[model samples]
Target: MSMVVTSPDFRWGLKFFKYLEIAKVNYFTNTTYLANFLSKSIMVVLRIWIFTQLYRVTYATANENEIGGLTVPMVIWGLMIAQSLNTATRPQLSKLIDEEVKSGVIAYSINRPYSYILFHYFGSMGRFVSNLISNLTLGFLAAFILVGPISLSWNGLLLGSLLLFFGYTLDFLIDLMIGLISFWVEDISAFNWIYSKSQLIFGGLILPLSLFPDYLRNIAELLPFSQLFYSGSRLIVNFDFQLFQKYLLIQMAWLVFFWLLVGYVFSKGIKHVSVNGG
Candidate 1:
């Protein structure tokens, strides 16, 4: 019998295998999924209880007067919207980047045809999609149970969805930029801690910017963090055309800035080579 042998496409096959391995590792060891579910559940429960207490207090104190131009329903909606829009990507991104650096696998990734930034982008998209589905479902359930069904017009719903998606993309890119700093820094734990805390405060996850003092509110509005939650929540409730345009423009500007920054950092990180002798 005659034998026939064909050479394999090693380069393409290797690349595909590498990506598959990464995906498998990420899927099986996704601790964030459990952590997110637990944390979000606690947050939703605590928030609902707090708001219910506030409503009782307000009813006892004043005879149906407006608090900061917000009725009880509006306040409830604002809280729900803000909580629902409290999306984040950095905690996982930082940990992934730090792991790569510590394990010395980043050197191999740097030598690959694909940019590390793009690799991280793919991994982050996986995580974000997972969280998006989980969080939105939980957020909707919490809103329904606590605030009841909200009546958003079709146009409002469409615009709010668009804004929310764009806001998420912008936030993801910003987190990637921060994660990339791991390439230069020895340890990123402190950076990650500070960044997460800042997000909690400035991203309007704790309280909507509407409740802030005027000066603090203005400062928060100018920062990119506000776009993460404040913009999307405001769109759902208020739907001001002019403000929407402004926030969208701001998101675009930050996207451009981070895109350039990531490019620059990747270029710099790739230039330094440290090959370990096997």
Candidate 2:
């Protein structure tokens, strides 16, 4: 076969390395503007404090060591993970896609040799990690101050991290899908609102699914949104290998579903770009 350099699958190592360098650059870039993240960082601290206080009162009032097999400390720590994951990735990733579509800038990228989706993926990843680390630090520190130390095992941390990576990737795909909608709509703000609310209500970003009534928890767990936040967050505080495996399967299933969906949407969206003389 003739040499192939343009496609990612051709010399996958080099392509992956290139993507990683992009991530590294973004990570460092995010570290520079501390103030840019001030609002979110402050929210992380405040939410942790509020949740801890709220739950402490709840547990105390009820005189229960655990509600639905979850302790107050677990709630605090899980919310830290949930908030960090929720807030870490710039919500602007989808906005970037929206902007490109509105300005017809995406048309130029459409015909480029490399994949546009992958380009944005790697580009956002650097900043995503940066934001994630910063948020996690603030969250964990807040939790520690509020609740003292937590006991965690090495295996739990490692496995929980795997779930986190899976969740983040799935979440990014969700954002990408929302952004791609800009091709059809003049504005994607409504879509964004619906998505954020869904994450909150279904993803259990505020309340762990465990605390939900049995019927609701069952329904929520089946959604990709819960996997985006709750599954990994729950795994961090209450690491269960069996649940991890189940979460992995559910996430993988959604990943494949979204993967095909994104392809279909992008393919249709690109046609619109062509019609727009892009």
Give me the runs in candidate 2 sitting further than 4 Å from their true place: 1-10, 274-278
Provide TM-scores for the models: 0.77, 0.91
Model 2 lDDT, full chain set: 0.84
Candidate 2 per-residue C-alpha lDDT over 98-157 given as tens digits, one digit per residue, 9 for 90 to 100? 988878788788787678888888888888777877788888889999988777877678
TM-score, prediction 2: 0.91
Score residue 14 of candidate 2 by CA lDDT.
82
lDDT tens digits, residue span 1-278, model 1: 12222335665676666766665555445445687545754565567558756864775587764554555555566566656445435346767767877778888877777757656666665555555555566666765677577566666567777877777777667666666677678888787778667777887665667667889988887788887766777777666778778888887787788778877876786665476878
RMSD of 1: 5.8
In model 2, residue pairs whose N, Cα or C atoms come closer than 3 Å (at least 3 residues apart or on different chains), thus clashing, are none
Q: How many backbone clashes does candidate 1 have?
A: 0
